[model samples]
Target: MTTRTLPMTEPATGLPDRITIYEVGPRDGLQNEKSVVPVEVKAEFVRRLVDAGLQTIELTSFVPAAWVPQLGDAEELLDLLGPVAAGQARPVLVPNERGLDRALDKGVKAIAVFGSATETFARKNLNRSVAESLAMFEPVVRGALDAGAWVRGYVSMCFGDPWEGPVPVEQVVDVCARLMDLGCDQLSIGDTIGVGTPGHVSRLLEALEGAGIGADQVGVHFHDTYGQALSNTMTALAHGVRVVDASTGGLGGCPYAKSATGNLATEDLVWALDGLGIEHGADLDALVETSVWMAQQLGRPSPSRVVKALAGA
Candidate 1:
C-alpha cells in the first residue's frame, strides 16, 4: 500500500532511475531447502517482506506436492496473507494447467509459468523438451489470461545450463519471443546455473533488443554462485532493464543443478542500489533482520555477504 516509486529521469545510459526489485524469497528461496518449513512460518516470511516495502513478492508455487512437498501448504499460506489486505502483488509459480487450476481456485490475481531455453534443462526439470514444454504452457497461459489473471513467463538457463554449456543468445532470444507471443505479460530471463557474466548479460539483452523485445517486458533473475550476480544486474540496468528478481537472505538454487548456489541476495542488491543513488523502496536493515530470522529458521548462516557483515558474523 506504500508508494514504491520516486521521481527521477531515465539516465543517459538508458537505465531507469527507479527499479522494481521483485522479491522471491518465500517461493524460490524456500522451495529448494531440504527442510519442510512450516506453513505459518512461510506466512510470516511473506508478511515481513511486505513490511520491508517489497511490493511485489513471489509468494509460492503450485507444483505437485509430491515434487515440492515444502510448499504443500500453499493454500493455507495464502489464507494467512489475506487478512493483511496490503495490496502487495503476490504472484505464484504454476508449472502447468493443473497447477494453474489450483492457483486460480485460490483466487490468485497473478501467476507465472516457467519454461527453459535449452532442451536438456527442459528434460531434466520438466521431463519434456523445450518445444513440448512450451506447448504445454500455451494452454496454461491462455487459461490464466482468460481468467483475467496477469501472467509472467520464466525462461531458465538463459545463459548457461548444467547439462549443456553456454547457451546461444539467439536461442534464448527465440524462446523469450515465444513466451511473449504466447501472451505472457512479462518474461523473466534466468541465469539458472549462475554462470553469466556482465558481457554475457549485455549480449543477451542486446539480442533481445535486436529481436524487437523491449527491456520493459523483461526481468532478470540471477544466482550468485560465481559472485557475479550484482555485476550482471548492473549491466542489465544500463541496458534499460528495470525489474530484477532477487531472494532474501540469498536462499535458493536450481534443484536440477547440484553445484548451483543461492540466488542474488536481496540485501546485496539493496546495498548496491543505495550506493548508486537508485530507488528500490526496500528497507535494508529490515531486510537484513528478515534474513537473519530466516537463517535461524533454516538452521544455517545466510549466504549473503551483506547479511553476514550486518549480522557481524
Candidate 2:
C-alpha cells in the first residue's frame, strides 16, 4: 500500500479526517497489572506516549490509594508533567469531589468521571446505584466545569456486561444524558466486556442521536475481549464519532470486571485509520516502539496484532 500525503484536516472520507485518540495507557493500562509499577516508569510511559504524538492522554486516577495502589502516585505524576495547557487534554480520573479537588490543585485542565449503564456494575464499581452514581458525579462535574476544567464522562457497559448480559440502549442513553446535563464536555460510550458487535454500535449511536446526543461530543471505548474492538470503532467512525479511547499495546482491563480484557490497542486503531487515510496525527512506528518498550517493562510481549506484526516486519 502506498502512503498518501494528504492534508490531515481534509481527508477524502466524509467523516472528520482528524480524530482525537485519547490514550489511556498510563492510567487504565497499568492499573490492571498485579505487579506494582514504579512511579518513575509510569511517568516515563506517559512521556513516551506524548512523544508518539498523542495529544490527549489520561495520565492517572485520583481514587483512594487503598483502592488502586497502582495509581496512588497520581499527584506526583501530574507534578512531573507540570501544567498542562488547553488542547493537550491530560485528563485524570476523579471518583469524587476530593479527587476533583486534588486535580484542580495541581492545575490540571481536564478530567474524566466514570459511570455505569448497568445497576450491577454501578453497585460493584462505584458502590452506588446507577442513578446514585450519576448523582455523585453531579457535584464533581459541576465543580470541575465551574473551575473551567474540561470534563469527560465515561458510561461503561453500554453494549453488554458479563453479569447482566446485553445492556439496554435506553439505559445507556439516559445515563449519558445525565452526564451531559451534569456538564461533561464529552461522553465516551464503553463496551467494557467487548461483546458489542458493529450492529450494536450503530444502534447505540442511533439511540443516542434520538436522545439529542450528537456524535461530535461522543467517543467510544472498546475492549478486544471477543475481537470486536476495531470493528466497533469503524462503526463508530461511520456514525461521525471523532474521538476514540485506546490503550497502548492493547493494555488495560476493568479491575472490577474480572472477565474484561485488553482495550483497543492504539497501534491497531492508528493502523486502520492510517489505511483509511483518516488523520490521527500519530507516529505509528513510534507508537509501536513505545508499546514494545512498555511491554518489556511489564515483562511481557504486546497483545496487539499490529505491534507483533510490526516487530516481524
Candidate 3:
C-alpha cells in the first residue's frame, strides 16, 4: 500500500516526563489468558499497577461469564479494588446497558464501549450488525455520560480482520466516526490480530484524520502477533496520538480471533518511550516486576522482548 506522508508533530523528545499507561491486564489482558487469575490476584495486580504509576487502569468487564469466564468476577473485581487516589481513574469494560448498570452500581468512573471495524467480526463478536451495535451503544454511551461517567470506545480490527482478511481504510474511518460522534471521551483502534505494519497504521491514522477525528482523541491498541506493534505504535506517535493501550508482561489475546496474541506489552512501550525521550511516569523496574509476577501467575513466558531482555540483561 502506498502511504501518503503527513506533517509530523515534534516527536515526543526528552526523557518522558509522563505517559499515561492504561493497564488493560485485568480486562483485555486476562480475558485472553488461559489461566483464570484468582480474584485476590487480580485485585493485587491492580494494586501493584497503581503503585507502579499507571494511574489509568482497566479493572474488568461486565460481559457474561459464559462469554469470558476468565473475568466472571467483574463485579467482585471492581468492588475489591481497594481504593483510588484523589486523581486516579479505573475504567471497566461494559458490553451493553446491563453491563453498564453493573459497572455503575459498582461505582465505575470510566467505561468502554467496543465495536469492531470489520462487519464480519462485528457480527460474529457482538452478534449484531454494525448499525445495531451502534444503536445499542448510543443509549449506553449516552447513559454512561449522563451518569457523570467518562466513556471510551474501542474500535477493534482497525487494520485487518481474521475472517475477512485486510480491512479497508474507509471502513475504519466510518466506524470510528460513529464512535466519536456518540461522544466517546477517547477511542482506541485495536489491531486485533496484530497484522498491522507501519504503513497500514499510517494510512489508518490519515484516514481517521480525513474523517475529522482529532488525533488527541485517538489511541492505538496493537497486538504483537506479527511482531509489528512497536513500529506501528511509533508511527501512531508521530501522528500525535498520545494515549496507548498495553498489558503487563504482554498479557491477553483474543480467544475468538485466531493467532491474535497479547497486546504490545507495557514494558515494551515504556522501553520505546524511554528511547524516544517521551515521558510515561512509569517505574520500569516495578512494571517489569509486576509483569513477571503476572506471567508467573498465568504460567506463561512473557511475549515481551523487554521482559526477556531485561530479566537476562
TM-score of every model versus the real structure:
0.94, 0.95, 0.93
lDDT tens readout by residue for model 1, 1-313:
8553322433344556799999999998988888899998898899889889999999999998887888888888988878435566889999999999999999998999889999988898899998999899999999999999999999999989878898999999999998888999999999988999999999999999998889998899999989999999999999899999999999998777786788999999988887677889999888999999988888989999888877763
Cα lDDT, model 1, residue 128: 96
The true-versus-predicted C-alpha distance at residue 82 of model 1, in Å, is 1.2
lDDT of 3 by residue, 205-306 (tens): 888888888778887899998889889988888778888889988888887886788899999988878766677888888888888887777777777888
lDDT of 2: 0.90
lDDT of each: 0.89, 0.90, 0.85
Candidate 2 C-alpha lDDT tens digits along 233-255: 98899899999999999999988
The list of candidate 1 runs beyond 4 A from truth reads: 1-14, 83-87
- Which candidate, 2 or 3, would have the higher lDDT against the true structure? 2
Cα displacement (angstroms), candidate 1, residue 144, comes to 0.9
Could you tell me how far off, in angstroms, the CA of residue 144 lies in candidate 3 after the best superposition? 0.4
* Candidate 1 clashes between residue pairs 3 or more apart in a chain or in different chains: none
- The candidate maximizing TM-score is 2
Measured over all alpha carbons after superposition, the RMSD of each candidate to the real structure, in angstroms, is 4.3, 2.9, 6.3
Q: Kindly report which residue stretches of model 3 are placed more than 4 angstroms away from their true locations once superposed.
A: 1-18
Give per-candidate clash totals: 0, 0, 7
Worst 10 residues of 2 by lDDT: 4-13
